[model samples]
Target: MVTLRNAGLSLTPRNIDTQSLSLISWNTDGFSSRPVSRASLILDHILEGPKSPDIIFLQEVTPFVRAFLLKDARVRAAFLATDAEDQTGLFEDVPFLTMTLVSSERFADSLHSQKQGQGVQGGEDCMLGRVARVTLPSKYKRDALCVDVVSPTAPGAFFRLINVHLDSLGDTLHYRAQQIEILANVLHEPGCSGGIIAGDFNAISPEDDGLIDKNGLVDA
Candidate 1:
């Protein structure tokens, strides 16, 4: 009955010939009484680094937490976030959502698309990408949040990073597979080299082991 709070960060070198990436995953329970405080600690840990991650994945992000992150001077200086703008009240009705934040230093020189939005000045220039919410068929009304980033290893190429909070609880087990399938389809979409899907899968079943491989994605 223990549910994991999920979050992750992926880091790749700017010019190294090696193709390695670093990832950190965490899920902050937005419903907790101290959501902002907890989130602040997590952010502090991520930023205080000998090894700062290039991309950050956050799940169950409440509006307050989102605003706090976007406004934090340190956070805004260090990373470009998917939730940088709340124009049009897109996230107003939702209780919580997922977000992706990429390192401004790493992507500072990379090519950016119109969908990623203009850079904001926060010590460093950060091109905050627009996050797309992919609807799910679950009764819980879950959806995946995603953003595109320029591949550090492959210059001029891009890949997608998806953050998801799948349906939870044993009663919703069937919906987990459907959720995986839908996201797996996104990985296979043309015009990108590949993608990484990470977050709270709510994996409580044995069948979850084979789900990623079945969809042509190897567990990392």
Candidate 2:
């Protein structure tokens, strides 16, 4: 039995006055018997409830669940998703993938005017790009889904918002570590203002502590 965990990551740069960026990540077990229903319940609570977030990251999303999320009235109106494209060629062999949804309202007109390189009220051109998968060595064919979103706090600055589902179980601890290292390198790339990585780590060993810590990441 897998436990579902919803994690929150807060972005706060010291000394700079910036509004809070609320983000939520959850691993929706797409293999479950009622994937769509389970996903709907989670969406209803997160989107309609008081804690409506600025960004939503979902992992283990199947084609069926992804379709429901994209077509949902509220989600379509409120968020711009990364998995809107036909992923058959890219994800045909993969049973599930990850997705990132950015709030259209929060990014202002940038999302709609992305092609023109228009600015959001507080920044230069801001846009949310398509998901880029980082292949990981694992029997499960796991990968990290990365989205580049303009930083709300820093004008013209962007951060790699990654939705990752690491290789599971205790035996794959080394694989998980390698996955984190690959992601950490992306965070430090030129022109990037760091990043926020979130998803199901499937931690089951004492060694799991170093997987994140050695990569200079903190649990949020």
Candidate 3:
């Protein structure tokens, strides 16, 4: 494993051989309002090493941020969803970066089998995207981001990758839970077999009793 530290944060990259497939997921804490200085800091961290991740699942990024990152030749591909909008009329201009990536051909084909629908009651407008060097065959397409990845050592076995950003904010727990259930159902449906789900869950760590702190606070 390779470890790098920056801005008081440390990231350890697991040394899975090049032959092994890998995926990365992270939440950018609402990329819309992040200052350029902070953004640059993050960009530096992402670009610092010889390592380039095959798939990245990022949440809370604006269109501007997405465009900035895409400018890097190493990015290869990207996707974004439309949930960054707010109901209170605030942040009308921030771009939903992840949604844009989902529009790409590589990501769309994987989700072809699933039903396409609009924003769920409590869930953020969510979408998925995928990127790789080779073009995935048409028949394997789905409405969600899907990609065909093959490990030379393990030829026949393939996996689908998914990115999801569940709901956050007040009274959204029920909505988030429902969304998770829906996702589970989709996974169980015929043809949608096993795959990796990545993205910001917006969930707090469980407490000592292993119970989620639904109240959003810890006892003092």
Measured by lDDT, the strongest candidate is: 2
lDDT per residue for candidate 3 within 101-190, as digits (tens), equals 332322333322323431111112112322321111222111223332323233333334445565555455555555444444444444
List the global CA lDDT of all models. 0.66, 0.71, 0.38
Off by over 4 Å in 1: 1-20, 109-131, 151-157
lDDT of 1 by residue, 1-220 (tens): 0112354434332332344455566787888999999999998887787877776778888888988988999877777666364445656667887777766675563222334453222213222233477999786678887665443334444456677888888888678888888888876666445667788888777887667777676665
Candidate 1 lDDT = 0.66
Candidate 2 ranges beyond 4 A from true positions: 1-5, 13-17, 108-131, 151-156
Q: Which ranges of candidate 3 are over 4 A from the true structure?
A: 1-19, 35-37, 76-158, 205-220
For each candidate in turn, the TM-score is: 0.79, 0.82, 0.51
Candidate 2 lDDT over 35-91, as tens digits, reads 999999989878876767888989889988988998999988888776475455656
Give the range where candidate 1 is weakest over 10 consecutive residues by summed lDDT.
Answer: 119-128
TM-score: which is higher, 1 or 3? 1
Candidate 1 or 2, higher TM-score? 2
Model 2 / residue 154 / CA error / Å: 5.1
